[model samples]
Target: MAVRYIPYYPDTLEGQARLDNFVRTSRMLFYKDNNQVKTRIQRGMPLYEVTESETVGANPDGNIVMHGECLSTCAYLKDKGIEIDLVYIDPPFASGADYAKKIYVRRNPLVQKAINEAEQQLDNSDMQEFEEKMYGDIWDKEHYLNWMYENLMAIKSVMSDTASIYVHLDYHIGHYVKILMDEIFGEENFRNEIVWCYYGPGSPGMRNFNRKHDTIFWYSKSEDYQFNDKDIRIPHDAKTLDNFKKGLDGSGFISENYDLDQNGKIPEDWWEMAIAGRFPKDGVKRVDYATEKPWALLERIINASSNEGMLVADFFGGSGVAAAVAHKLGRKFVHNDVNINSIQTARDRLVSAGAEFTMMEVRDGVRLFRNPVQTMEKLVRLIPGLNTETNLDKRFWAGSIYDSQKGKMPVYLPNLMDSSSRVMDKTEMNHIIREALPDLGNDVKQIVVYYIDVEDIEELRQFIHDENTQTDIAIELRDLKQVLDDVVIEDKATWEMSQVQVELFTKWQIKMLTFHSDYVMKKIEAFNLIGDQQHQKKLANNKKSTFKPIKISDEGLECIEWLSVDCTNAQKDAPWHSDAEVKIDKTGTVTVNGTKTRNLWDATIQSDDKPLRLKVRNICGDEVLFVL
Candidate 1:
């Protein structure tokens, strides 16, 4: 358990000490705080329920899609006593790398302005594209181990005794995680260290062999785990067939019988496949998500590990490939991700598969900023004079702002990663007054705290005043909503609905006319502002640089990443449902329902139900609902 007995154990003293420190800290994680997830679950946590009564077709309520962090979703499932037959998670590789999604501004060719500009040969190719950080895999080794440990334990608690878990990771941190998995699932239950091999063009200056394969450590919960070898058999190669024809067996490695099942031979632990969307000619369907995996890889894993109608889960759920494949193969699934963009992408992907599933959220309170990394990144831009470049980069302090009148005020942004930290009550106030404020040093005259919620303002003030006898540092509280309110704008779009008959079938059709995303335009404006400053500097200094600014046509339907119509009647204060939808990728490729087409949009969506509400998601994941 201490990781001392690993193969080829480091003999050096320093290596041994580092490993000791890691093991020490990792064991401490056993007692680490989970922020009262168990207590919350005892108040009736819901596990996923798939209407698994499948006979001949897909069941709409037989699958589940969740919008939540991995831990919270796992906790919900474990609390509900839901058991998974197989799990395939392609989690972050912890390589300290940041991945981003290409954001595009949509073009509406049907609009009058777009039509006239197109007839006049307005070059749409000059439109610039930008990327938004989807997630960051920057984690300290010990912290990454701790997080992974917690997640694996939670996942194991929800797995059946005969279930299998395939953790797909690259070369960066897979070795360390394998040790943790060994501890959690037991070393004897370890099945295979599958190597998924692929080829891609590398730089000419490359000095080493390209990391063309990813490691997938397959572990079973128990010895009785399912594995249908024939489900994923490959055909015998020509050389092997010839050798068998000549009455020569290739020794112990090859089976004695050349009649090794006429169907084919079982594939080896290593697989030669292709990455998703890398080669357009390879014909892999893609959603353009930053870290999506290929479908073929998942199909083989699912086919081998789980039978038809078994429940599978992917908590990371990037692009929902695992869940989608499970549903396609007649298996139930639960897909979860914390990011809204990921959830939306997965939702659209599942819909295209005609999957019948209910969308659920981990009820761990409302998220103001949602994720920690992006929250800090946005705070630098959201707050005008806030600076994070300070020696006081303590745990609670978000950053500091220098004011001539007030001196230095350390800003406090709620830890979005922790649910209990979102709301600032007397408990949080006490922690700040006693713990966080003392560390800020006497130089800090005021400690500014921004909170999403407070139990009672008067009570909090009284508690702060009563508890502030030790420190003279004043507490200035500000509502996070007030600071972030102006930044969140409701996007505007125009759409209409009509009854269209297709092949004598009564269908409700909705057409997207134009869309204006303040989120997209704000980023574009900020981008252009930087360009303007560069232009001014160049004019003054007489220099030149290549920086293209983003331009948009009047009708901005192209900004719409995915649009849907809730043909299911929208009752009073009822939740929205996606009945018919269309998605536009970065290259302006349009995907309607689940069908991909190179034809012009015609800007229409059709469904058997009547169109009641319209939902449009911008490229940056900001959504606005319109009542039809």
Candidate 2:
């Protein structure tokens, strides 16, 4: 279980003075959890490779794509003595906005529209496109500051002496973080506050000027750092070039022999580039992931800060534009994010660029909890006999179950959305005995506690034995993993493997005939129910409603987003080595093995080696591996 440590939030003037003095004296901010986090920083977080995934035309030294929290990830990097040269982190801005990814059903162009009025009439509810929340940015100011303090300290330890870091933020709480960055990186190392300007349609209501830009704070680790001044220069406009050539002053901006690099002039601290999805329906640079930065923005930062062979890292890497751009520019990269979508999207983008990297997780005992929010929502029905009928204290009991032998049993479940609560430790167990047990009603004969991870099973068992209760009520502990072992509804698939002669050469081909995701169907049904309710409300108000449920094409390929065949081995535990792969983007554009292909999926893949297994990723980024 993760140890509990409350961070020192400066809430008052005295508290602020204490924090600032601590920073001046210790050269680090105050975090009550610092010792716990520092232990991992000094040692390291346990990391294991999920799959090798790629090795084609990759750096010999290797690139890393990690899935975990930023502070823990930095700890692992620090323990390995891996010094990063450039770091760009676009972390949670504490903007009170919960960003979500737009999940779209793939369009199967090969299928013909079905003209079945009877079938359509039976299911009148519609399946509108849904957005899945990636992560919550809402937080108390104190809590947010505490979290950022620990992360900044951890990240700084792994940076090289000549490294540079860029912290991206906006007007929401950027001013507060600017002070923190000054304390962490030192005031002397403070460099430029880059203003990234962009534009969009304004709101209809009258208000002040629209806030349409983000702030990027760049700082260096030391007095001397890498800055490719010549490589990042901007091209001069036509008028400026004419003025220089005609020996005329450039409107008082240019003097005699005021020579700049022949390449271009040095750009100012401000940049004008639109955010992702702002482009004209994805002009080859837009990735569908939320808050994805433009490739050109990353390209400029990478070119200006680091050299070709140096390592670049992004801890809060959302869509992985930083890593992809780094790899494209002949630099090694390390990308880490807790969201599976971020990791999967970034991994696919890198693969599309023919870059290789090692995929790994921090081994938090949450193999299937990559998206814990949705998992928690599904737990209510998954657990047998569970109901929200707890007669006892609601604070401690999430729900209760009725058993013939045991009577009424209240159940306690950790909040899977919060990482801190997923684990069961000494402190949590002690609280259960002291606070929870006292609140239990007389009818409660038993109580069940579920934990995703634990500190020590034997110690916990002994703790229960040592602690006595005023009542004879029994307490039971169970491993949540055992209950959630079959949590993911596996997708059923049918395929044929045979030898096909193409261009006089016999090659093995695999054709996917049909596919079905039970999870996807259930999600559609849920959306249909909501649509039905909305339709009824509109009709009650005497408004005409044309509510049609979203229907899957007859081909049933709309649920799939990615497919790959691992020809190397059937070793399920090892890193996956894809012999052939295909992915469908938001626009239904199919890409085969890092190259753009036709607009529609061919439903077949060719491979030189015999296919060993198949990996299919649904539209929601949930994946299932099948033996071929």
Predicted structure with the largest lDDT when compared to the true one: 2
- Which residue runs of candidate 2 sit more than 4 Å off their true CA positions? 1-59, 109-128, 236-263, 277-284, 379-423, 426-449, 457-478, 553-555, 586-589
Whole-model lDDT per candidate: 0.72, 0.74
- Scanning candidate 2 in windows of ten residues, the lowest lDDT window is 6-15
Query: Which residue pairs of candidate 1 clash?
Result: 51-62, 60-356, 106-558, 106-559, 107-558
**Model 2: lDDT of residue 369:** 41
RMSD of 1: 7.5
Cα miss at 496, model 2 (Å)? 1.3
Give the alpha carbon lDDT tens digit for every residue of 327-370 in model 1. 78889999888777787778777776767777776544333343
After superposition on all CA atoms, how large is the RMSD of candidate 2? Answer: 6.3
Alpha-carbon error at 353 in model 2, in Å?
1.4
Model 2, global lDDT: 0.74
Model 2, span 261-351: residue lDDT tens: 5798888999998775232232235577778888878888899999998999999998888998898788999999988999888888888
